[model samples]
Target: MFEKIEMMRMARALGHHASQRQIAVARNIANADTPGFKAEDVASFTDSYRAASEPLRTTDPRHLAAPDWSPADRRTLAETGVSPNGNSVSLEEEMLKGAEVKRSHDLSLGIYSSALDLMRTSIGRRA
Candidate 1:
């Protein structure tokens, strides 16, 4: 029932995306000094949502269907300049990305809270 709500789905997706991004950022920060390590990040939430929400298409009967897309499945190579030692992670950039993830997660939580409040009010419960 509640799972069918588009708003709920979107909020869940946003939370998942934020969590994945935070993990990626943390990994990048941890590997900042590792030689030959490339920075990795997930695609933007909008892009990931669009991709994940897209209907799967089958071009041929013999062709295997594409796996459903999700926030965790959208890893991308970040283009942070490589250092002389071939490490691509940058502390400043990772910190900024972490902040962005925090903000996005907070926004998702706010939306979820508002939805719950609306539901409670509709049911005559104190919101």
Candidate 2:
């Protein structure tokens, strides 16, 4: 239920999420050969949606903290540079992530087009 709703919300952005994800993946791949380059991953907007969807149960008035400090704060990229090289980005991982992002993006566009086509047909019938 949540995944579908999140995907629908993403639909409104017209593939923005997928595009940004692709860009991030590409950046990671590009920096793969560079030294001290940490791979950056795209955060799923669905996480925020899920957090907002969950019912908040506060036992006390001060139970709820600031929204910014919420545990649901999405962290996409992993922290690197604990070592000297600081090169955490891996080409293989970046490529795989990129492929997945591309597939999802294509699927999203297909769904969007189909929905638009259905709307067109409905209007045409009315006419």
Candidate 3:
């Protein structure tokens, strides 16, 4: 019972994280037109996975893992182009990123739902 609950909790956490990434990607796409706007991405899944899987052994408080995006690591990789007023937002790239994030969110939801279903089956329905 406890293990089932733990699995469900982990799945929920992953789903939540993926949802945040999707939201961030959508925001980036929406702000592509504004001047001085820079595209932003949440921290990579690799970082999140590492933080979740690894045991924390930090001596200093500052060394703890961040639960969200890192502004310092954010990069503006949009191509240079002129829209009559110099802006680097690439519609193609933004669209692709948005699609990818949406897929990721769907996948996360599937995993969570499937795990919950399995747990329910294992518990067996009361007659």
Candidate 4:
């Protein structure tokens, strides 16, 4: 349905990414007391959307071309300076990440709503 629209499609993906980050933050917070537990973080979304997009195949003058590169959502260990007990999870960092996840989710919703409004307007309806 809405996935046909590029803006809506991207917004949905962003929302899912935000959810994944939130889970990572929660895991870090839960393991804060565990020994040798490393802080984990999901990759950021600002890494250009087209960074992993496949090269566009164009056969006519109306089409454009791009590059070929793939990016993965790697859960890499965060270096926050390990504590005496070898636990790397920091409550402060997790809290900040929680805030970031909220912002990202909000942005995703905003974009999705805006795209919907555009569609409504095109269909002769009020937003």
Candidate 5:
């Protein structure tokens, strides 16, 4: 029943997006010293949400529907600059991204908690 709620869906999506970003940042940091390693990042949450929310269309009834997107499916980010070693991961930039992910994840959790409180109050339960 709770799964049908739009707020819950959004909260879940936000959480997933943050988690994906964290993983990407970590991977970038881990490969900072590797030669020829390019940094990758997931699409913006807004883009992912818009794509996922689009109505599904199938030209052939026998064809299976497209699967939902997960955070692990990352796209290569355009390089701002590359070191002489051909590595694009910047430790400072990755650290900033990590901090942003942490903030976003916290916000998502806050929203989820608020939604639960609202529901409980609406149902005449103590928040």
Candidate 6:
């Protein structure tokens, strides 16, 4: 199955991360006027994927075990600095983030489609 492919999995993760980041950007834009609201941002997909993809190693049994990892549970953190009204959300920044997320999402979909095409070609099927 294509699920067994590492590149496929990575592409899926990239799409998911883009979705989550888009949600954060939406929330930031929606709460731009709220008092004492801080802008929220998701960690970059590259960093998160790198950390999750790395193999865990334990030199000794005494070492604390690595906990189960899932990108779905990644915590959204507040962006530093705030305006005079104590709200950190910036509409301009959110717009830029939205654009970035869109590009990432598109890239992921392209990767997935290309990989799928390759798979089909390998199986003697036309894509």
lDDT of 2 by residue, 26-98 (tens): 7877777677777777566466545655676778887855342132324377554423577788676677777
Whole-model lDDT, model 3 = 0.62
> What are the TM-scores, per candidate, against the unseen true structure?
0.88, 0.62, 0.63, 0.81, 0.89, 0.83
- Model 6 C-alpha RMSD vs. true structure (Å) is 3.6
Which whole-number lDDT from 0 to 100 does residue 114 have in model 1? 90
* Candidate 1, 80-110: lDDT as tens digits: 8999999999899999999999999999999
Q: Rate the local accuracy (lDDT) of all candidates.
A: 0.88, 0.63, 0.62, 0.80, 0.85, 0.84
Candidate 5 stretches greater than 4 Å from native: 60-69, 72-74
Tens-digit lDDT string for candidate 5 (1-127):
7767888888988998999888888999999999999998878888888888786899999988765545555466846599999998888888888989999999999999999999999999999
Q: In model 1, how large is the Cα lDDT of residue 82?
A: 90
Better of 2 and 4 by TM-score: 4
Which pairs of residues clash in candidate 1, taking residues 3 or more apart in a chain or in different chains?
A: none
Best lDDT among the predictions, by candidate number: 1
The list of candidate 6 runs beyond 4 A from truth reads 55-69, 72-80
Residue pairs in candidate 6 whose N, alpha carbon or C atoms collide under 3 angstroms: none
lDDT value, candidate 6, whole model: 0.84
RMSD of each: 2.8, 6.6, 4.8, 5.5, 1.8, 3.6
The weakest ten consecutive residues by lDDT in model 1 span 65-74
Q: Residue 115: error of model 2 in Å?
A: 0.8
Clash totals, every prediction: 0, 0, 0, 0, 0, 0
